[model samples]
Target: MHRSERVSMYGWIWRHLPGNTWVRAGISLVLVLATVFVLFQYVFPWAEPLLPFGDVTVDEGGAGR
Candidate 1:
């Protein structure tokens, strides 16, 4: 089968996960939490300086003066 017809990486992981449905759900939740922790602790901080969010502009002394 073609790559597009193949199962997604997430689907493959879910199928390969051990135990029953509840166990898979718990594992999935842990994976999500770990992913989020890594992003906030490392990825976001490293990428913050390269992002345009810090260039925010605000109206001084109220709007429509």
Candidate 2:
């Protein structure tokens, strides 16, 4: 693919972000925080039930005793 088409999602976002270096940095930080908030507040909780981690079993009476 061409360079433009090969550009990463992050690179595309950076190019589209408005303002100078400092303002762009601030906006990037806000975007990151917003993404994390959404993942933790909605995504993780919603997907938790679908994960296999809840079925974990431990061999308490076996090795490492």
Candidate 3:
């Protein structure tokens, strides 16, 4: 996106936020925490079984002996 579009989007978000800096900061923090909680609780568990992250096997030659 262009610089003006980016700035406008940010300005829009800032204007929609409910309060001064501290309250907005608190709201942003809550949003971030909620996003993390949802991902860990629901998304990660559902995706865990589909990932190829299990049963790693490695073979090493005896040349180091």
Candidate 4:
């Protein structure tokens, strides 16, 4: 809840991660990449049509004149 609590929580996770710094870094990188891959492959495709970014139009009335 507080700043120290959040920091300690992260510290606990870091301490619990197995292996030395390089191994832990590799594991963290893989986890991050996997999360991104899942989000792009499944989540983004399903949510794309619901987003308002697709069709954009601008009208200048004097263009045809």
Candidate 5:
């Protein structure tokens, strides 16, 4: 509230919390997103499959077909 006291949120986080905690959190998030992306694109797609034989048609009257 006073002009003499400056608020530093970034400094407070790094000072009060363990540095590795932040780093690990960031790494975990990146890994999670990468896994999801890989699964969606290669392992198993949510929208459409990109397998070796291409998207199969189990339902003949599906929207895509």
Candidate 6:
């Protein structure tokens, strides 16, 4: 197809992308990252720490029990 014809077609499809699409996409990304952070920082610890290499018996700074 001609360049102009292709541009017009692409423009029409681009216009149909909802105004809120970018907002929703951004919010979704933030939500996903927050969830992952929570899982790693809190949720995984509640269940069990993510890495076995980390201390299972000692708290931070390797203080005594």
Best by TM-score: 2
lDDT of the candidates, in the order given: 0.94, 0.91, 0.84, 0.84, 0.67, 0.69
The CA lDDT at 42 in model 5 is 75
Candidate 6 worst ten-residue window by lDDT: 9-18
CA RMSD of each candidate after superposition: 3.0, 2.1, 3.3, 3.8, 11.1, 10.7
By TM-score, is 5 or 6 better? 6
Q: List candidate 3 segments past 4 Å from native.
A: 8-12, 55-57, 60-65
Cα displacement (angstroms), candidate 2, residue 10, comes to: 1.4
Evaluation by TM-score, superior candidate among 3 and 6: 3
Q: Give the poorly placed runs of model 1, Cα more than 4 Å off.
A: 1-6, 56-65
> lDDT tens digits, residues 1-65, model 6?
77766667545655655558687566667767998999999988787645676655855766554
Clashes of 4: 0
Error of 6 at 30 (Å): 0.2
Off by over 4 Å in 2: 1-5
lDDT winner among the candidates? Answer: 1
lDDT of 2: 0.91
Q: Rank the candidates by TM-score, best first.
A: 2, 1, 3, 4, 6, 5
In model 6, the runs with Cα more than 4 Å from the true position are 1-19, 49-65
lDDT of 1 by residue, 1-65 (tens): 89769888999999999999999999999999999999999999999999999786887867877
Q: Kindly indicate the candidate among 2 and 3 with the higher TM-score.
A: 2
Each candidate's TM vs. the true structure? Answer: 0.72, 0.80, 0.70, 0.67, 0.40, 0.45
Worst 10 residues of 3 by lDDT: 56-65
Q: What is the lDDT of residue 25 in candidate 5?
A: 70
In candidate 2, what are the lDDT values of residues 1-65, reduced to their tens digit? 77767878888888899999899999999999999999999999999999999786888787768
Backbone clashes, each candidate: 0, 0, 0, 0, 0, 0
lDDT of candidate 4 over 1-65, digit per residue (tens): 77766666557767888999999888878878999999999999999999999676866665676
**Which pairs clash in the backbone of model 3?**
none
